[model samples]
Target: MWNKRRRHFESYPEIVIVHVSGYGRPESGGDPKKCKRGCYDIISQAYSGWCKLASTPEHEVYRLPLYAGNYVTALFGAMEMLVAYIHAQKTGEGQVVDVAQFEAIARIIEMYYTQCIITLEY
Candidate 1:
């Protein structure tokens, strides 16, 4: 069982387990770039695009206030934790919450496409 400190306790009565990660399980000496990009290529994965948006084209990278991808992923992580919390209240069973930034952003982009196809609203 993981905790807010980002460590797993791995025992019963696990109150809260939140895994907020940029990439899937950490590996030894992996490409720092690839870990950030992950398996999907979405706008949230576009570091260059994000930098361009923030008006800092000096390099392909810049420190933004929100860090959009991580921020959104963390929000999703909180939502997942909330759902798990509600379930725990009902069933008295705790579960781990694994949330990946790339996955969240990819899902968000996918949902946008889905909405565009279904309603052509945007």
Candidate 2:
């Protein structure tokens, strides 16, 4: 189904295709078994360490009160789409934007951790 759509879209150079998934392209890396699994907000949070960051003092972890993973994934997906669209406009060639929800959440986590590390004294 995706292959067919990709082929069809190949003719439309101005179109920017965005593929958002839980893990990412199966051929890329990670557990192939999990690549077949679909991910939701809670799943992404758990896999991406968001739940750990949101854990209570007792070490009881939980999903964010809101669906932060979903929203963040969407925001990142949108950003990728826009950047790909701009590239396509300039090159007159369409491109696929592959966004993994896990990576998107991890990016936010990594960004926060990096900032903390930079500010830490020891």
Give the winner by TM-score: 2
lDDT per residue (tens digit) for residues 2-112 in model 1: 243334333455466676666544432335665565433334466323333334446545434556677678779889999999987887777767776666766656755
TM-score of each: 0.53, 0.80
lDDT of 2: 0.82
For candidate 1, give the lDDT of residue 71.
Answer: 69
Candidate 2 residue-wise lDDT, 1-122, digit = tens: 67776776876757787888999876556578888898999999999877876676676887786888989999999999989888888998777678899999999888666654787421
Off by over 4 Å in 1: 1-14, 26-44, 47-65, 112-122
Top candidate, metric lDDT: 2
Weakest ten-residue segment in model 2 by summed lDDT: 113-122
Candidate 1 structure lDDT: 0.59
What is the total number of backbone clashes in candidate 1?
Answer: 1
Candidate 2 Cα outliers beyond 4 Å, as residue runs: 1-6, 27-30, 111-122
Prediction RMSDs, each to the true structure: 7.7, 3.3
